[model samples]
Target: MIVIDEIYISDEVVEEQFVCDLNKCKGGCCVDGDAGAPLTNEELNEVINGYEKIKHLITAEGRKIVETEGFYHYDQEFGWVTPTISNGMCAYGIVDEKGIVKCAFEQQYYAGELKWKKPISCHLYPIKISKSKNTEQQYVNYEPRDPMCNPGCVNGQKLKVPVYVFLKEAIIRKYGEDFYEVLSQIADQYYASKEAKK
Candidate 1:
């Protein structure tokens, strides 16, 4: 692990490669999970603030759910998360003609409607951030998993894009540019040290 200030980064974040292949996964991460995308207090406010602008992009059923249940719901395991429809699809999700589910917030963000793209947690997929127990330190870990995200992992390997690099923008969004600069330097040295051992 590489420690920078209060953040503890998993070595796999610098070693493993990952790039989301939406065609293969069909944006399964938005629909297949037991819980909705995790949300922070700030993100919750953003959703509430931007709901009106992006509400039209959601599915009819999803919009109804959001209307009745509000933007978020409480999950015992996940704390505050996006509400889900009967099929477990996120309330902020809409399937395209290709049958790939996409986030409404991101769609609106790209369309120049919203300032933020989506929840930071959703933006930073394959890299989960959680606070260490009984401490103020935050852990940044690579979270590539099987079946759903396997295509992304494979593509990332083929493209030689490390997890940290693939999620560069989101990392910077969450932890600022300076933090990422230091992380890049540390990753370079980390890889060099590994090569030296060989």
Candidate 2:
């Protein structure tokens, strides 16, 4: 484990490889999950406030789910989460012509319609962050979602991209550039030490 401040990062985060293969996975991560995308308290407010701006991008069914169930709901396991449509796709999810699912919030974010891109949990996918009940420390674990993430794993292996490198933008966005720099340095040393042993 790599300890940085209050965060405890698992070795897999720096050792394992992953790069989302959207074409191969067809964005299954957005639709295959049993529950909707998890949201923080602040993110709930952001989704509520920004929904109107991105509503046009959502499908009619998605809008209906959101309009009837509200922007989010409480989950026993995931706490606050976005509501899923009848088809199990997130209410904020949009399907492109290619049948690939996408996040409406992300679409709006890139279009400059919203400042917040999407939920941080969604942004840092495959790397789940959970806090310890006994301590104030947060654990960051690399947990790829079974078959849904298989294509990404294969792609990452082919590209030789570590999970941390593949998720650099999200890491920097969540933990700042300084944290990412330190992580990169640590990862370099970790790999170098392994190479030396070999």
TM-score of each: 0.95, 0.96
TM match of model 2 to true structure: 0.96
lDDT of 2 by residue, 1-198 (tens): 999999999999999989999998988888888699999988888998999999999989999889987999999888999998888889899999999999999999899899999988889998999888899899999999888999999999999999999899999988999999999999999999989999
lDDT of each: 0.91, 0.92
Clash totals, every prediction: 0, 0
In model 1, which range of ten residues has the least summed lDDT?
139-148
**Highest TM-score among the candidates is held by which one?**
2
In angstroms, give how far residue 164 of model 1 lies from its true place.
Answer: 0.3
Compose the digit string of candidate 1's lDDT tens values, residues 31-121. Answer: 8886999999888899999999988888899989889878898888778899998898999998999999999999999999989899999
Superposed model 1: Cα runs more than 4 Å off? 195-198
